[model samples]
Structure formats: C-alpha cells, structure tokens
Target: MSENTADVTETATEGQQQPIELPADHPLVKTLAAQKESIKELKVRAARADELEDAQKTESEKTADRIAKAESEAASVPSKVADALRTHLVALHGIEAEDAELFLTANDPELLQKQVDRLVGQSGKRKKSNFVPREGNTSTAGASDERSFVRDFFSGN
Candidate 1:
C-alpha cells in the first residue's frame, strides 16, 4: 500500500505546472514589469481623484457647499429653540418633566405659559377624592361556624 501511495504522489507531482523563467532583458518580461508599474500609478490616481477635484473646485462651488450647510442648520433652529424652552420650563417653572412634550408643540408661547402656570398652581392644592368612609364587620370565623352548623343540620348531625 505504501508503494502504491508513493507512485500516486509521483504522478500528481509530475502533472503540476512548473514556473516559467525568463531572462531580465527579454521583451515579454520588460512589458510585464512596465504594466505592473502602470497599474500602481492607476490605483494611486483613483484613490486621490475626489480630494484633488475638491481642491480644484471654483469659488462658486465652495460657496454653494457653505450655503447648503447653513441651510441645514437654519432648518433645525425652531426645533432646537423648542427643546431649550421645554428644558427651561421643566427645570425652572416646576412643570412635570414627563409632561414636557405637551409644551413642545404649543403654537403660542403665552398659551403654553398659561397652561404651565395653572398646572403649577394646582400642584399645591390637595388632591380631591370621591372616596367615602364606611364601616363593616371583617371577622370570618362566625360565618365559617354558621356554614358548618347549617351543613351539620342538613346532614342530621
């Protein structure tokens, strides 16, 4: 079995490709080396294309980019102001922190302030209740005895 395995291994090695060697001055070898250098130059140029293009941008193009950034920040101003207002009311005016969402959507600041004032005013008042006081016997032993007595009477005990 070992001799057969050796023969199989020799056959496999004989079937594999051997590396081709060429002289340094050969035309094919020179052409391949030049192509490799060209590929490296192409990869570097591709990586730098976007940055080089930005550096060469015209004044108007740079201005347009700045304007776009400013517009995005301007669009967020109202919401940012609302958030600051919500935080101020909750921290300084005694509004429940969880209820700040209501103030965020109020169209009129005065109306929101009025609502907050009312809420804070009522916060100090006693909580009203519809609960009424009542009294009743709570013992269960007498009921249990009654039930047992009725059961024994029925069974003729």
Candidate 2:
C-alpha cells in the first residue's frame, strides 16, 4: 500500500482516526492560517483596552476638577457675606468710612452692640467722670482728649 494509506491504517488500528486535512474555507481554520491577521487582531484588542483606560482617566480628572472648583466656591461664601456686612454697615451707620470698615471687618456687630449696651447701662448708674458721653456738647479739649483716648484704646497704643 501507499505511505499515506499505511499511516491511516496504523492510526485506525490504534482505535482513532484524527483527520489532518486543512479546511481553508472554515472560519476558524482561516483565522488560524494567517499569522499576520492573528497578530493584528491581538493588537486591536490591546488598543481597545488602552482606549478604555484613557477614557476612565479623563473622566476621573473631570470629576476631580469639578470637586476642586466647588470647594473653592464654598470657601469664598463666608468672606462674601462678611464683605456684604461691611458694606451695609458703612452705608447705614453714617460713620467714618474707614471706621465702619474697620469695625465690620474686626468684630461681630451683634456681639459688639451687646457689649456697648452693657457698658452704657453701667455708666448710667455711675457719676460722671473723665469718660466722654456718647452724645453731648463738650469742650474742644475734652473732645480732643476723648478722640486720643479712643484712638489709643483701639490701637492698644
């Protein structure tokens, strides 16, 4: 017999006939036939994975940027409220613009008003002394002294 027939007979005697013909038209067979095509398919899969990773990275960066911007805006709100209070005080008090600005910037108005009221109540019960009245006609010397005292007291000088 021929060599091919002899090998087939030997394989048949071994209880199995494993077919070795290449089916060039079969989808799986065709895929395995071209090494360059297989490599190209693998590269395409790798590129898809890289694209997914880069998309996730860009999304995370946008989320982080939004969070940072929100935090910055939230931090400025209190300062904006404080500035509004200062402007209101300057407009309402008929005070020296600088003095109103300083008072609003330096102290809580509600707390300062409570303290001043308490001091005024205490002064009403006491006899007049060197302390200048909040509203009264006074000598020029007395006015200068009171101004100097107020300036020195506020400045801690």
User: Which candidate wins on lDDT?
Assistant: 1
| Residue 133 accuracy (lDDT) in model 2 | 68
Error of 2 at 148 (Å): 52
Candidate 1, superposed: residue stretches over 4 Å from native:
1-47, 102-157
Model 1 steric clash pairs: none
lDDT of 1 at 119: 68
lDDT per residue (tens digit) for residues 65-112 in model 1: 999999999888766765566568878976665666654355455655
**How well does candidate 2 score on lDDT at residue 11?**
84
Please give the range of 10 consecutive residues that has the lowest summed lDDT in model 1.
102-111
List, residue by residue over 41-156, the lDDT tens digit for candidate 2: 99999999989876778777878979999999988876766566656655554445554444434345465455444544554677567876666865556467778888789998
- For candidate 2, report its TM-score: 0.32
TM-score of each: 0.39, 0.32
The candidate scoring highest on TM-score is: 1
